[model samples]
Target: MELALPTEILEDSRNKGVVTALYDALSRRDAEAIQQILAPDLEWWFHGPPSHQFLMHLLTGSNKDSSSPEFSFVPHSIAAFGPTVLAEGFDPARSIAWVHAWTVTDGIITQVREYFNTSLTVTRFSAAAGQSDCSIATLHCPSVWESSLPGRVGKSVPGLVLAI
Candidate 1:
């Protein structure tokens, strides 16, 4: 008998695919495909050096004439937590590491938070038991993924690098 994957697994795969497709489009500089993947009112947040903001240039169609450094986010690993998908990549030759946090809603990316060079971490916050409001819950939030600072020395470590 054939077996079907669980709903959560299926959803995660689909979301991952969406994020992957977006990255593929980005690498190709496919503006049409990127437009199709991103929502009209996409919210973007970027942290790190302004000089390393290659992604912003890509999205806004700037730096077309300049021969700037390229940062292709080829995520070695991707994970999905509900609608949020996290992709991380590093370039040892260039001494660059990046993390892209994409929120996919109904198969379209509505938001993206980009981090580069420094470090990254993803923590999931759940209200403590008997704490009705998370806003008031001064308790500690669980750490989902803690990563080290990228671009340490030499080539990056194999696989995904998570730094807190």
Candidate 2:
């Protein structure tokens, strides 16, 4: 008899892939790939200094050109909890630190919360016990999670705390 992975595990793995591939595409400045991975009406939120909004500037730039990227967000560690994926990196020399919280839907990334030069801690709030029901919106039923981050082209996952 073969043992299959649980649905949540499969989803978590897939979500990790989607977010990882996005970084690869972004590094390559591949507009076509970025467009394919991101949803049209993507939701976004950012916290930190106004000057460190490199990702925002990149995303808002015209999609017409695959110009060289101004900065890189190469996360040292990436973790996926249900539909939410967190990537963190830090640069000590430049004093640059960041974290990205991504929400993926049906293999497409629908939302992202970005942070710069901030510490983040993700807490898990599960539903009442004995709950086995979960909807698409609440993919990981009984489990509501939140974050926290770090680092560089140099890889550092700083100030990111994941609570189970």
Candidate 3:
């Protein structure tokens, strides 16, 4: 008769695969695959620097070519923080984003967050892609104000302000 492992062991094993897959997808710049693993109602919150803007700048190849600074995760350790999985890694060049993910219910990832030094990226790309600093991406988030406003206020904000 086959035997099943304990729940904790199974969960932990899955965590490793999930973390590895995330890194692989990101390095390959596979946005579709990245979105696929996340839950449909995913709450992806970002901190540190504006990666989206950075990506745009990078792809434009004015600041940096589409190719990112080659990075590979040197996993230091893995731990579960609340419902989130934290994979600590050391990137000698500090080029890649450090990811944190919170999964809830049926292996569905509910939230995801990433951190990285934008200044470094901007500098690196500027040198590599041979373009002057067009505009360094800022970290301010419009969502901060939106979130503070009353719920459903977003629906009203648009109608209230008619562009003349």
Candidate 4:
């Protein structure tokens, strides 16, 4: 069954499109495509284990100093809340999962905040924040989700925690 995004998210088409295109470019491992979507000076932040930070290089295909393994992330869900877009990406082969929140402005992706293997924990906050009834929802705020990945059951999905 296909899940539907909330109406509020649907209303913000431009940001949503930018988020979707960014993921699509990453999945294709198309550096040129990614560059087109990202801002010239993108601000990327990584949270969690130190190793997880390498994801920025992976996404941008810019690990020239070391040999980076090629991997694909399938986004299970995507939602746009205001200028930020939240997505859950999972690599079934490696049993790895992550939630990425992209901040888009003027058709360019300006910032990306990635949380590795911590979708469920952060999702709980979405419910409490009352952003939306959907599994994930975005809010127009600065606070981001912070949680550990453990005892998480079922498929790895991304959720948005809105502070509004």
Candidate 5:
């Protein structure tokens, strides 16, 4: 049997509301709420080569710098991508941020692949604090899915599969 994809795009109002809730949770540094939206067996990866889990640790309040007295976060965008979602933004005063993520089951966030651009982070921070002229880099997903198929082994199967 083919597995059914589960997703409900609420009315734009409700959708925006959920996104707002997520943003509020992040602003408060509520790790639990953050984790609540992730898949348990998540396999987060980066544009670089680091494991997704490692990136998640850094984003999920498990960092030595997390406890620093000068950290802040602001989530600018959170949009759905089929079964996944992409969020990009930064702490207006720090060099930390992320990119794409996959939601596996039960609203649980599984893999959280982050891309930390220190320069962008600094620029955003300065802009937010009214002390700089830097434009923040927005988050975006590449066109990898449309041109590839995922196998049971999680490898990309090149072109789209034919119905034959």
Candidate 6:
């Protein structure tokens, strides 16, 4: 059965859809698709540990190493306020959670702010503009060490920060 979402939730869902589409494009290495979603002059800021910087390189195709492994982002929740879409990325394998704030204008993403391992702060400030800060949702996992498995070991630490 199709359950209808409220108008506000539907808008938030649409914004989240954009983010999901962007991630899907990146995962497929489809530059053309990414170009369609991002503004001509995109501004991004990432705050976290260094290991996560690969996201920038990946998006920009700066890392020429073909052997680099592919990574995925799993968003747990998404909310929208004005032109901003705030989503949470939960990486259970690394016991980490990141919040991404994407600002879209005319269906194009113009700016992005990523906060890794800072879900608490991100959620606190994700309330509607002019509204007092309110708590946001988070994803929970039982085990985050799966990424450390023998062959699955990743070079990047459990922490990460990337901006473009």
Q: Which candidate achieves the best lDDT against the true structure? A: 1
Evaluate model 6: give its TM-score.
0.62
The clash number for model 1 is 5
Each model's lDDT:
0.78, 0.77, 0.45, 0.67, 0.43, 0.64
The predicted structure with the larger TM-score, 4 or 6, is 4
TM-score of 2: 0.74
Off by over 4 Å in 2: 62-69, 128-164
Which window of 10 residues has the lowest lDDT sum in candidate 6?
140-149
Compose the digit string of candidate 3's lDDT tens values, residues 5-120. Answer: 98767775676566666667766767777666667776655455454344224222354544655345544555543344655444444434343434544555666544342111
Error of 5 at 13 (Å): 8.9
Q: Give Cα distance to truth, residue 10, candidate 4, Å.
A: 6.6
Instruction: Give one digit per residue, the lDDT tens place, for model 5 in 60-154.
Output: 54665543463444556665543455455544343334443334334444554445431111101223444355555532223332211112144
lDDT of 1 by residue, 1-164 (tens): 99999998888899999999998999898999999999999999887778888888878868777786666778877888778898878887877777788899999999988887645667666777787666744555666764454547564443333322
**What local lDDT score does residue 22 receive in model 4, on the 0 to 100 scale?**
77
Pairs that clash in candidate 5: 37-109, 38-108, 38-109, 39-108, 39-109, 39-110, 42-110, 44-52, 92-125
Can you rank all candidates by TM-score, best first? 1, 2, 4, 6, 3, 5
Question: Which residue pairs does candidate 4 place in steric collision?
Answer: none
Worst 10 residues of 2 by lDDT: 143-152
C-alpha lDDT of candidate 2 relative to the true structure: 0.77
Candidate 6: stretches off by over 4 Å: 1-13, 66-68, 122-164
Candidate achieving higher TM-score, 4 or 5: 4
Best by TM-score: 1
Q: Mind giving the per-residue lDDT tens digits that candidate 4 earns over 32-91?
A: 998899988989877656765656668654665776566566677776666777777666
Write candidate 6's Cα lDDT for 42-150 as tens digits: 9988888877665677777766775646556656666666567766766667666667778877678999887766523322223445556454443222221111112
Ranking by lDDT: 1, 2, 4, 6, 3, 5
User: If scored against the real structure, what TM-score would every candidate get?
Assistant: 0.79, 0.74, 0.46, 0.63, 0.43, 0.62
Tell how far residue 116 is off in model 1, in angstroms. 0.8
